[model samples]
Target: MKPFSVAYTSACHFGVIAAVHLPDDPAPVPDGVLGQLPEVERDHARTLGGYRQVSFVGGRLALHRAIRGLGRRAGPVLPGEGGQPQLPEGVAASISHKRTLAVALAARDTHGSVGVDLEDLGPARMGIADRVLVASERALVDQLPAQRQWTAVLLRFSLKEAIYKALYPYVNRYVGFEEAEVTPLRDCQADVALHLKEGEGPFLVEARYQWMDGHVMSTVRIRSGTPAPE
Candidate 1:
């Protein structure tokens, strides 16, 4: 297999986004690439079948590149609870991928956990809107022009996925789609409102997104341990 290459890299509010393009053929990843990863990651990749292994390896490659961009040596990104990336101390990171591309976001853990997600700009599938959006969000989508509704739903979906990733490390639980609402603003930014059940309160979260090679890339940062407002 040909070596994977860095597609692009950009700075986001939370950290840096690194995207890598996977090989066109679905052939197994080359030993050279696999050899570069930590033994644990290599073993885990071995267990995954077909394109899954490809995605896993590509995501780690992108992550290592992102870490290097931060002037840090890349460490083993083991799978933590829920298979999230177990980043090195003082680092926060997230990974997402499509068939041909993998993206990662990495930042210093000074502020909080960070998450990143990538989604293709395909037409929305039927009934996906109902599944992803809360009532109010659905109402907002309904007001958009017909052609833009799909993008609207997808933008919120991508943002919510990033939001969940950023918050899950702190909450240590499954946060439902309804648990948070995203109101997208201009300039590829959005505001998130968390409605966690009593006792899950007090996380400061923010999100941003951009278009990359016909895909929607979203990211979020979450700060925990703060007291709820009086």
Candidate 2:
């Protein structure tokens, strides 16, 4: 089968953002290549279901290639305290999997942090929107056609997830849903503002998303010292 896709972006001046999509069944990793992952990763793979294992390894494989493409070597990407992948020094990456689709995004140290998330598009469940959306966002959704509200909710949720993944390492804590908001822009893009509960941050993350083979993919790139958008 043809490989899914790989693309680069200049959204972050400090480093290029590269994304990879694994569409078909993930290619098997040889022992040598699999060995490149840290023991935590290998051990974690064993704990996942068969399909989850494929995605887990596929994500690591994609990250290896992404980092290598930057002309640098990233040693075994390990799992941190929360099972988030820990990139080698001077690098940051995020991975998301949806069914057969696995996407990974990577950036160099200068870029600060990178995060990407993929979610299958579907209608929002009752009460979900209220739980995830802030006041202004909910008002915007209310103005849209009833049928369209679910999509808006899903988009906001996905953006928040991407933001959370990007900031968790720095925050060292879980960011709440009510604490962040996403405002849509044209061409499948959005701006996210996060109000860190612990007063550590009021950071901003710029996001762009696309529909790929039935999934919504959102990517976030945060440059070091990037201030909140006015």
Candidate 3:
């Protein structure tokens, strides 16, 4: 079967996810991306690099693949709380992978930052939304058409994750899901507005989302200097 492929491009940002149904047993490293990992990362390379598993290896590859399109030599991929990847010195990045897909997002900002996440818009067996989505978000998403509700919830989470990743470096504090609110979809993007009642006050963040081949991918860009293309 021909594997599924999804591509997204914005300004200097590019992301791609190739389908992988193979077992996550450390498949042989691909010809191009193996840059001999440090002893720490090598121990779990097989498990991490293989599909279906989420580990440092998967994170590194997602980070690398996302940045590859920009012709960058981003040093090593750094890790943060919750296993999120730290962008290179000046780049803003966020990554997410599920089952057989991996997605990365990056942006160089003058003021604000950017984040991107992709998720499988399938069943809710994980009950992940309970921990992440606020009451309001669930209320709205649950009302979406049966065929679209799954995508709506998936995009909401994906967009929020991207926003959190983009804001982490500057704010240096955890942003709750409730503080972030996603407006109805406009064009291919969604307007993200936030009201941080606990740590900070209200602010605005803009995000975009798209559904492709049963997967929902979203990107949030919050820049201070100037905005980039969607």
Maximum-TM-score candidate: 1
User: What would the per-residue lDDT of candidate 2 be over residues 110-201, giving only the tens digit for each residue?
Assistant: 75687788888853574788788999999998999988888788888888888888888788787888988789887788877777678875
Clashes of each: 0, 0, 4
Candidate 2: worst-modelled 10 consecutive residues by lDDT: 7-16
Best of the two (1, 3) by lDDT: 1
TM-score of each: 0.93, 0.80, 0.71
Point out the higher-scoring one by TM-score: 2 or 3: 2
Local distance difference test scores for all models? 0.86, 0.71, 0.60
Tens digits of lDDT, candidate 3, 115-147: 767777677543666766778888887777777
Model 3's C-alpha root-mean-square deviation from the true structure amounts to: 5.0
Best by lDDT: 1
Better of 1 and 2 by TM-score: 1
Query: Could you give the candidate ranking by TM-score, starting with the highest?
Result: 1, 2, 3
TM-score of 1: 0.93
Pairs with backbone N, CA or C atoms under 3 Å apart (clashes), candidate 1: none
Clashing pairs for model 2 are none
Shift of residue 21 alpha carbon in model 1, Å? 0.4
